[model samples]
Target: MDIKNIRQEMALLDDVIPLEGHHYAACLQTYEAASSQRKLILEWFTNHVIPQIPRDSASFLSIGCGAGELDVKILAAAKEQASTIAYVGLEPDSKQCERFTASMALPSDQNIRVETLNTNFEKYTEQRRFDRVLMVHSLYYMNDPERAIEKALNLVNESGKLIILIASNDTLNELSSSFWQMENGGSTWFSEDLSKHLDKRGVAFDRHRIKAKLDITSCCAPESEQGIRIADFIAQAPTGELPPGLRTMIFSYLEATSHLDGEMRWLPHNVDAFII
Candidate 1:
């Protein structure tokens, strides 16, 4: 099938498959995994990244910070260090942003000054640059990831860091291989490719790449279980119906994997830490 046909098929699947709750649950599970990863990321930042910074007070901008799992962890760390860190989270999804803000208001020792911006990173502009800018697991949704990276770079101050946590092309290719085979599609976006594209755009940057594996078997329990509650939200068209084959394929895939142990297993997620 042609690329256009593939896109149409995928769109059809998206329409018919009511996977919003599934995705929401999956995101929560992924966030829990990310919470674990956050510890390592924090350690890396504290031992290596933070010391490199020249200032005691740092401003951090996270594009698509999701439910603020990483933000909360980072803010808690800053509290321990007695550092003044300002955090700005940009999330396109209003619901998720609301959840993030609600979660941030919880009692904590972390003197985290958080501001949640309900807007896209590309459309949002800032008068001042940040000490660190990050896009964690959210760049793939962007239509123009290269431009998004440039926009992120523009938000960074001199000697500041641009941190990106993205699934490697290889990892995505592998995970989606079966789905692609079943549906006939190609690969998704990549962090390394984005980095290379950034370099081609005349952006001088460095990279610190790392990989991690997470176990998420507990999250995908039966739908009745409260392990990870995800809403299966499919975008409905005017017809409000999905193609038969597309819907079948998606649900079948979900069913096949629902009971399986979910793990990142060598799924190399590139954490490209760029210094400008």
Candidate 2:
């Protein structure tokens, strides 16, 4: 279950499912019960990160900017703080790029402008740097995560920063690991590993933990539509039908690690924040 093996399996999954669609959206909705990850990140950005940057005009580049929610949030915060901002988003899906473009439509009076490119980061050779380069929840999907990290770091200006947000291995790792193990898949990448990648490359960074939770109560039911959907969502590698034994094992592992409160089964979210 090394990095190389996990990456090969992830590439295979990506070939099957392009990482965007109805099931993916549904999975995101289900995970909304544990929203503290984004909240804490946003809080830190506004209160701590933004203030530390002395520049009044900031540039941001987002790789795999899904739905452009983070871009919108960043722009809104910048406007409130009287900071002029320029944002560029890179996404492979045309539909998602369209959404990212639409989400960036700021009012005439606002001090923010957005541009989007419909392409994956690996193929994008545009040479430009920005004040803030974002890789939120997108690094793991890269074809070469190390290369991508290096490219992103190279794109950061002297006064700029590379902000990365990823799920810690401690949270939801068992379910994904078990799913891959059943299929002879390898280990997946997490924030902890990403930090190691940075360290290996001699990149300096600051790490922070964001406390949150994940609700997997419905995933306990293997046969139901919700259960299957949850499995597909978290595994991100749903092929045809999952064997019953694998599903049972996944649910049992989830149940074992989960804490039940009323109708909600809460699993602690280990969200790690990296700033370079």
Candidate 3:
């Protein structure tokens, strides 16, 4: 249960896995469940967050903006109200950046400018701040989450805000705690832990819960390609190269806990959003 050794395990996973498209197919199975629950986060952002930005031209920075899908949605929604937005993305993967740039080319009546920096947030610097800064589901992999949060907060202009989305510690992360803790004595990563660090720093923030779940029945299918990807994602392993015993344990865990909601076999998620 040595905390220092946890990073080594994380690094091993990072070095071994390229996460591109690993969750895409699995996501397709849970689309209905995901869409219904995730809409709340989007609605909150549009109603509460979008109003914070200036109606004129505004700049946005999204760390780990994979393929710019959410950015596009935000931009399109902003357009409905006649706001101009310029997007800057920071993503380490070149292929993802390329996809982000390509997807943003859609013809739109709204004023928009798109740019992607193929770099990690730790090394990125800007002369000026942005109207909005987002770190969605990206902080878990950071070597230093507190520092990353601080850096993102600094990038927000005087009137802008830094928004972060992470999983609540009491929920799914708790279910999958054995793998993440590995030999670590306690939970090291999760929204609850992040909130504590922020609180210790006397940082003021607002919190909201976004209820969501994934139907992973397909993961249990015969030959289970989706199941394999689910395991890879949970383990953060590139090839899902888990020990036979560990794989069996994880599969048993998933099967036992999967909730049946009518026709859906749901794996519930408790996601939280922090606005600072």
Output the number of the lDDT-best candidate: 2
Question: Which parts of model 3 have CA positions greater than 4 angstroms off?
Answer: 1-38, 108-110, 174-188, 238-240
Clashes of 1: 12
Better candidate number, 2 or 3, judged by lDDT: 2
Taking all chains together, each candidate's TM-score versus the true structure is 0.67, 0.83, 0.82
The positional error of residue 215 in candidate 1, measured at the CA in angstroms, is 2.9
Global Cα lDDT for candidate 2: 0.71
Q: Flag the better candidate by TM-score, 1 or 3.
A: 3
| Quality of model 3 by C-alpha lDDT | 0.68
- What does candidate 1's lDDT look like per residue over 100-206, in tens digits? 79766746636557889999877786767988887776776576776777788788898777877665554223334333333333334566676777677786666
Model 2 Cα shift for residue 198 (angstroms): 2.4
Q: What range of 10 consecutive residues in model 1 has the weakest lDDT sum?
A: 230-239
Score residue 180 of candidate 2 by CA lDDT.
46
What's model 3's TM-score?
0.82
* Candidate 2 per-residue C-alpha lDDT over 1-276 given as tens digits, one digit per residue, 9 for 90 to 100: 233343344344323332247566666555553445667677867875666654578888989897787678877776665467778998887877888888888668556778899998989888788888988888767756778888998898988899888888774665564444444434557887898888887878899888877667777754656655655666664523444444354456567767898988778876787889
What is each predicted model's overall lDDT from 0 to 1?
Answer: 0.57, 0.71, 0.68
Clashes of each: 12, 0, 1
